[model samples]
Target: MLTTNDLMTIDPETVTADVPLREVVAVMNRANIRQVLVVDGKKLVGIVTDRDVRLAVNSPLTTEEPLQRLELLNGFKAKDCMTSNPRCVTPETPIHKVAELLSMYKFGALPVVKDDALVGIITVTDLLNQMALIPEPKS
Candidate 1:
């Protein structure tokens, strides 16, 4: 049975609450990742994703603004757009269980915690990778 720790991306890319959204996008682009954990000190506080940025950019309030203006304003800070109180999993959680939770809740990723400390993250991509590694069942 695979555990979350076995498939999770350890020391995953993270951003500080005060980091500008532009910087976050740059980091995500550089890392080729779609999601980033928002941290304060050493504690995981929230999560930010490309979807969040898209929502902010496409919001009615910002729709009429010029691209540059929108980017400048929307790119304020991670805390301004991050999803707080994000659902999390533990290192000991079974991979299948995490998959179930993610599917049931429509979550793309889940932070892994131990003693309330951030350890890693498991994303849908990670789960897909794990599934790919599994052998096919006999017919």
Candidate 2:
């Protein structure tokens, strides 16, 4: 069984909750990644996904109508809208199990943690790429 550590993207992108939405969006776009871990001193605190940013931009957090993209982006921070306490897996978690969790939850990615410290991340794309690399058994 392949462990998460074997397949997870190590040193995955992360951000502090206090970071502005603009910066977070910039990082996500630059990395071409959908998820970013929110950490405080190496401890996992929350997570922000590309979906979250999209939804944030669209959500009317206040009574203000027709909020412009610039207004929304400048008005919020990661902690104000990030998904708190997202489900995570460990380094020892199996690849199959990770796939199952993603399928079951429709999660874009799962943070990898060990001893409560954020370590890596595994995504559906990662799983697919890993599976594609497997060699077929011969008769």
Position 65, candidate 2: lDDT: 55
The deviation in Å at residue 121 for candidate 2 is 0.5
Q: Which pairs of residues collide in candidate 2? A: none
**Ten consecutive residues with minimal summed lDDT in candidate 1?**
65-74
What local lDDT score does residue 33 receive in model 2, on the 0 to 100 scale?
A: 94
In angstroms, the error of model 2 at 34 is 0.5
Cα misplacement distance, residue 24 of candidate 1 (Å): 0.9
Q: Tell how far residue 98 is off in model 2, in angstroms.
A: 0.4
Give the lowest summed-lDDT range of ten residues in model 2: 59-68
lDDT score, candidate 1, position 114: 86
Writing each residue's lDDT as its tens digit, candidate 2 over 1-139 gives 7999988898988889999998899899999999888999899999999888888887765444545777788889999889999999999999889999999999989999999988899999988998789899988
Task: Give the Cα-based TM-score of candidate 2 against the true structure.
Answer: 0.90
Count clashing residue pairs per candidate: 0, 0
